[model samples]
Target: MEDGLVRSISSGLSQKGVRDHNERLLLSLIQRHGALPGSDLARIANLSPPTVSAILRRLESDGLLERGDPVRGKVGKPSIPMRLAPDGVYSYGLKIGRRSAELVLIDFCGDTRHQRQLNYDIPLPDTIFDFVGAAVSEISGALSPEAVARICGFGVAAPFGLWNWPNTSDESDAAFQSWKDVDLRVRTADISGLPVTLMNDATAACQAEHMFGRGKEFRDYAYFFIGAFIGGGVVLNNSVFEGPQGNAGALGSLRTVGPNGESMQLVDMASIHQLELRLREVDLDPRQLWTDPDSWTSLSRYVDPWLGQTAQELAKAALSTCSVIDFEAILIDGAFPPAIREELVGRVRRYMATQDTRGLIPPRIEAGSIGAKARSVGAASQPVGTQFML
Candidate 1:
């Protein structure tokens, strides 16, 4: 476990100066489990107390970490906890969905300090970049010089094949087609004037959940994010395994049967778009599903059936994933209300219980805590992780 902790927090850093690696290890530990005193950090990181104290002093002096109020125990001296300074670093996260684009300015601790969004029938590259450029300027202009200096980079979360979506109209299709040739990371950097990191939208959501939600509870898990379409990511050895080509857990493409016994992907039967199609079939407005207030009480009739089918499909996908990786858990999250998410998770768990698992150990199915913001928050974490963590 000690060796794993070392590798997990700062992989491939053994050759670097011990102090540099140890500093990151301490920061990573605090980020994962919140504020900790030097003593605890030393024990967790397996560093000497003097080494931990020296690193902590340097980090605190550099503004990357801040001291908390001294906690008095019935022991020797009062231990002052340390945590990541909220203003130590900043990054912008852009989540480009089929229906909307969101730009968020987040602090070191992953809290959104400001955000801007644009909604449209379909995403156009020109409009997205325009929004991004303007939003970045507006947000940065409002910050103090010191705060602005702390801005690290920008991250974008987008689907892999942006051009094939919606399939709505010729005009929208043409607009999407432009995405096929557009270089997202380069374009975003040009607009934002900061180092840019791009990630798969669903994978970004998994990152957010892993960093800020329930991922700390397990060493490995399969995460499924139900957006307009369902997608997923894989985590192994306490790190997201993006695979060789950076597409590890493409759960949405998992083979499944359609209603009439036709072959299909999990996305075909499990995406929220299917629920939107149901609403369209009955001439009900589907816009409410994406709008604020998040409650879908009026659409419960349509949502109920969608939840049932989605849950069953997710159950099959979860088991299939575990068959390959033996994941410790399966996490489910999406662009929906908490109540609806809870219902979906419960249904998935029930469905999994009835599946055959003679050669497999069933993994726990839990709801993700990040909800709709996971993708954007996950995107923002990229630059911070690149600079400060493994």
Candidate 2:
């Protein structure tokens, strides 16, 4: 990230942080369990009735929570249920892919209120920052003063050292070298005047899947987001395993034997970048695939080899990941059209089934529910996650 990030805490805000964390905990519980009664909240939160009541009052007064009509059934007093106020809070997410930038505004219910995408061959610093500023201004129109004020901040998810991938993005090394080693988070914050949190693009997508997609039903899984370059995140018992440098689930970096039995990274075979290379070999316009997959008629003929190679490599990566930490499922997603995603998942599943699983149970393979917006949604979710702790 070109901009530096806002630290998660300030020196004197620990007390306030604790209160906010507790509030977020309650909010998360409500989101997970649906509208909850005060009594149930007290029990679930392990708080006394009075404490829960007080917290509920605070949340209700702040408009972060709303109460349902009192229920009158089999009790001396009717209990009023509470749930998140969708209009009360909003967060922003920015996903900077190798080819484009996306901005999304999400509400408390995890619904995308507004989104905008800008495409470019290579996202130069000035162009991307300008686009973000315009997109933010545009999204602000969709929010009221209260929701705008409630905006936690922008979460940025971009490939680490994105400019270094001249081959994947098809840009001149001389032009993009300036972006190398740049503190994108710091620069983006400076340009946008909003607190920014950074995460690896793949990890951000994984977070999106867990919070908004099928991961809500599975505690452990290996997640792959096959964007321009394939990247992924690992979830262990519900938490994403962000390694020491926050690049833990980079399945793209996993080594595998190539078709010629040469050592190569999985990304070299499975990523959309490599797929584009395959299309270009047959003299097809690669941009058509991303911009308008429906118009790319040659996909069935030209992409078979790409799919076969990608599926095989994906299986290899999944097996390797599962060998170390057995998971309940394997999720695959990317920037492709929905039809293409399903096909890729199906192919990978078949290939994975043919592999040896004598020492471990084969995780169920499936397509992730969230699609192209996963990165932006995940990035935007950071503020919500940080604000709520869950």
Candidate 3:
């Protein structure tokens, strides 16, 4: 009797271990492939058919996943797919930019259910923190307390040098007066009461692209985000290339020659903010340019010359970068709407098609799939992605 009881206890512990391992594997598979069939999960997770069946049953019982109807294929039995339950978990993401903050709520499957944007005029650090907290509260209030309790965490895509302000010498500190000595992570976490994962806006945007957009096809690529700043992120072997001190792909600092032989940083040449200012100078409101077809058509003619100049600088940067990293592609994504993006991509592609680089493949240039919300959406995935860390 004593031996039998010991054997039963050992079996129970072994089963628990198996369950835990399968749970993690299942979640990772869902994250990677979105929704997949049980057979595919079994193959990806390397679990036997029986084990996969048992695990899926247990997971469904726990409300972590739901099984859909069997899908019929050409030559095989209909296979039922399993998906992460929409209500199983929640994540909040906040993208903090120079002039605006975007808040997004995502489910375990990386689906955005709610999003809001808050604009400010040179917001102080305190106000930024308050705004993020209020956004979180607003999102949380929409759900039940029980559902809110299932929230995984929050991710913040903050400005790249937010924490380095104080160390930039007393003179530089005074120059960036509002940003100097701000502890964004600690203060924001205190207000939100959730574990915060902070990353540069461009880095977060790249992460979003890698997981859900065009970069999903390549293991290595460079993602350039042109918004208020020309930001960038590098993916090496399907992971973010976070350099020492977590500043790997700050591409905005790359200096290139602009139109009329003037030197300017890539940020100055490519950022939407600069384009907006130029539009305003021409007595055209950028908001109208974005929405009205006639305004866009007129704006396109003005933008083409500037875009050609920007494309030249971008090509120079890409050539230099490709010589070093040999990335599969260099993707350009911006806060510009789809129509504008298509126009820019068309011009960039035309330029790139003509350039000849020796002994290296010319990197493909394409518009970002996630559009303007890439950073916020990428931020939403951070918490859930980190949970899979060993």
Candidate 4:
């Protein structure tokens, strides 16, 4: 035993876990295709006809799956199709950012049924916990009793080591030091009396894109999410490629040159924070960018510098990432307005064209449809994904 040669009774939910896994596999396929015949489900799931039938029957009885309009043109009796009943399940997601907190509820179809948000300077842990508690309670209380009972769980998305952020940023305060050791998931779950899961804000946003965005069209890509700071994630093949410690696509830390030719992290030149800092120099109310994006359309003089810097850094990161891995597309999404996102991505694309990139395959660069809610939607989608998908 001292030498580490050990034997023990190992235990897990062996039998039930397999059944659950199989059920999720079937459901995921149906969700992807919209609907499928029992025979098709059997073939796709690699299960026998009888086994597929049994699972479908069980799911139908549970109100999670149901018979769709029958395919009547077949030679045999019309083959019945099955599809998901969106009301069968629900989930809650929370995104805590440096500027605001957002809570959203999604149904089986990934549509937000209700949402709540607040914008304020991020405060101490106690204040945050209270806001989360009240937000969860409000959303849950607003749901019908039956719908409330159908909730799968809650998922949280926030930057990792956020409390230690002040050390490097101007926003830092000594009070935030208390967050260094807090277990946010456990604490939030404890107060809400519900299960909870946590993920890096960027990773969660990537998951949302993988499940609901251009991922529906491509199997691999790099995702860059812009907010107070730029962040990103990589999807390899059909899954999120969280390498080693899960910072695989952390584009915020990409090495780049600033306007002054000084070396800097990409976030320093390519994020909303940088844009705000530029605006602050002229005494403009930077919050106007968040509360009213339309006004920015007239401020090209102030925005052009930030745009040029961001475009260069983003192109560099994309080229660097493509050199190591093959991707069908590079997606850019952000908390900024739709017009802002589109223009930024376009500038990045045009800038990339001028760079002396040879032997490196270029992929289609596009905007992410998930937009501002990517993190929250992706966060909530995780619990549903783990519980009901393979």
Candidate 5:
């Protein structure tokens, strides 16, 4: 009787281990390939056909995966493609900007289910956290209990400087003054009751483009995120290179040469803030200018010179970085509309065409696929990506 009991326990443990291994493999496969047939999953996962079949059955039973209609080809049996069930899991993303913040809910497939934008009247420290916490609670209330339960965690995309964790006496004193230095992860997690991952807004935007946008075509490139400020993120070997402490791609503050051979920061030259300020100088609201075609044209004309100078500086930085990293292209993305982004890309391409650099090939410049929503969408993907280990 003792021998029989021991055999039963050993068999159960062996089965549990196998199930866990298969679960990991299944999740990995779904992440790498958006949707794939069970047969193809066996090949990609390097699992036997029987094992894949058994795992799929278990996952389907658990409501983790769903099968679409069989895709018939010129081959033998029609294969059914499996996809992550959209409602099976959920995650939240927050993009905290200087003037505004965006909250988004994403499903397992990285699709946005809901989104809300909140703007601030004043840049007060206390108000910012209050608004963020309120938004989380409001959104959570809107979703079903089951949906909320599936939430793996929350991802936050904020300014690079905001991530400095306090240590030294001076740093601690500075943290008290700057809201950015406060441990947002702890505060947000406490309020939202979920794990939080904080990353640079530009870096998160770049990852969104890489995973779900046009950058899917290239493995190595630099993503320049033009918004209120011009920040960038580097992608090497198809993954974002978040440096130690997660501040690798903060390009806004990098000093480069302007048209007059004077030193200028990328943010000062390339950001939409410059253009908006220029519009305000001429007695026009930028938000109004963005909507009017004539106002947009005038604003573009006013900003073109600085934009050109910014592009040149950008090219120099791209060339210098690419010489070391050898990326396939440099992607230009911004919070601007498609028309504005296209114009920026065209002008930058024109400038790059005339410029020459040594020891580096000029990278193809293109606009981002998701455009302005890249950062917010990327932030929303954090929870789903983490759950699936993507």
Candidate 6:
């Protein structure tokens, strides 16, 4: 559980107006710090005990929270812990990747109750939306009527410049270019019959790490999510800070010199797509990289070099960002196995050690807890976070 100074309810609002805000705050607190008792919530929220009790009672009566077994303390009456009811609310998360797409139905507690995935040579708008419509219908139909009613909204996590990537065939390139004019939030709402929120896929992954991974330990950090293309997010004061246009941490676009003295972006240097291209050069099947039961042992000879180069690029990028914001940590995660992520983090740490840091506070380089599912889970969190949290 994360512990720190939490925002307290303002005394300026009228009691009637404050109820909704207080309710959301309590729910957000429970979501952050596991199950907490009313006394603890009151202290953290700076609310009177009676007011906390009133809000908790209302939340409990509404089926949004559930009480746990009582804990008998040293002298006072036993205190009962309260937590968000897992079945109280639900939302759908759809991740549209360059090489694949994923859909997940997550409960209020951020658990994936149902999920589906599709792999494609190139992402076509019509095919992806069709998949979204069909999957939402199929999954929602299996739930009880009450559960279906609790479905809040849909979230889509996709790349910003989806139309820019090169496709093998000109026909495929033309088809993919249609993404330039597509409005993901509006399209998804029309398909899923739910309100929609759209986010950059890597930013969504950072959100998941902030809420459910190691992000709790640092109030501010720069997050790098290595996908087909590397991208990133910024966290300030323990919150995922999506900028005004929602693309604050465009880490991939940071400039760097390539091997032959040409300028390149971090994406070209550190992305897994580079590894895929190398595997293809040697006649090894690259599809295994994205396979479910990931077996990268056979590809280690290729992966090792990629890891080294990626680590060096990431070390430079992390330092570059910190030179501006002085972040407390740098979190690295990706669409790969845990062991690979660990190795990548270790390598980044080693590389950072060799870089000159005369005046900067060196940030902690940490591995992300959520593996391949971070984007989908973070996408799911968008609706849940908006509706019932601060």
**lDDT winner:** 6
Error of 3 at 219 (Å): 2.2
lDDT of 6 by residue, 1-390 (tens): 112222222435555556788899899999989899999999998877887898899999989999998999999899999999999999999999978899999998888999999888788999998998889889989999999999998888998889887556789889888898998988888888898999999999999999888888889999999988899999998799999999999999999889999999999899989998999898987778888435566678999999999999999999999999999999999998899999999999999999988789899999999878899999999999998998
- Report the lDDT tens digits of candidate 5 across residue range 1-390: 122112344556565655665676687667656778888888776676777788788888877799888899998999899888888778788887655678888887778888877665223456667877887788888988888888888888887554342223565445446765578788778878888988889889987887778877788898899877778888888777889987787777677766588887777777777776777687877664334545555666676775666676676666766777778899888776677678778877887777776666788888887876788878777666655653
Q: Tell me the lDDT of model 1 at 101.
A: 90
- State residue 344's C-alpha deviation in candidate 6, in Å: 0.5
- Ranking 1 against 2 by lDDT, winner: 1
Tens-digit per-residue lDDT, 239-274, candidate 2: 777889988998889998777899988787788888
Error of 3 at 92 (Å): 0.9
**TM-scores, in order shown?**
0.94, 0.90, 0.84, 0.91, 0.84, 0.95
TM-score: which is higher, 2 or 5?
2
Task: Answer with 4 or 5, whichever has the higher TM-score.
Answer: 4
Candidate structures ordered by TM-score, highest first: 6, 1, 4, 2, 5, 3
**lDDT for residue 261 in candidate 3, whole number 0-100:** 83
Q: Work out how many backbone clashes candidate 6 has.
A: 0
* Alpha-carbon runs more than 4 Å astray in model 5: 1-25, 163-176, 287-298
Better of 4 and 6 by lDDT: 6
Error of 3 at 362 (Å): 0.8
Model 4 misplaced regions, further than 4 Å: 1-15, 166-171
**Global fold similarity of model 2 (TM-score):** 0.90
Backbone clash tally (model 5): 0
Q: How many residue pairs collide in each prediction?
A: 0, 14, 0, 1, 0, 0
Clashing pairs in 1: none
By TM-score, who's the top model here? 6
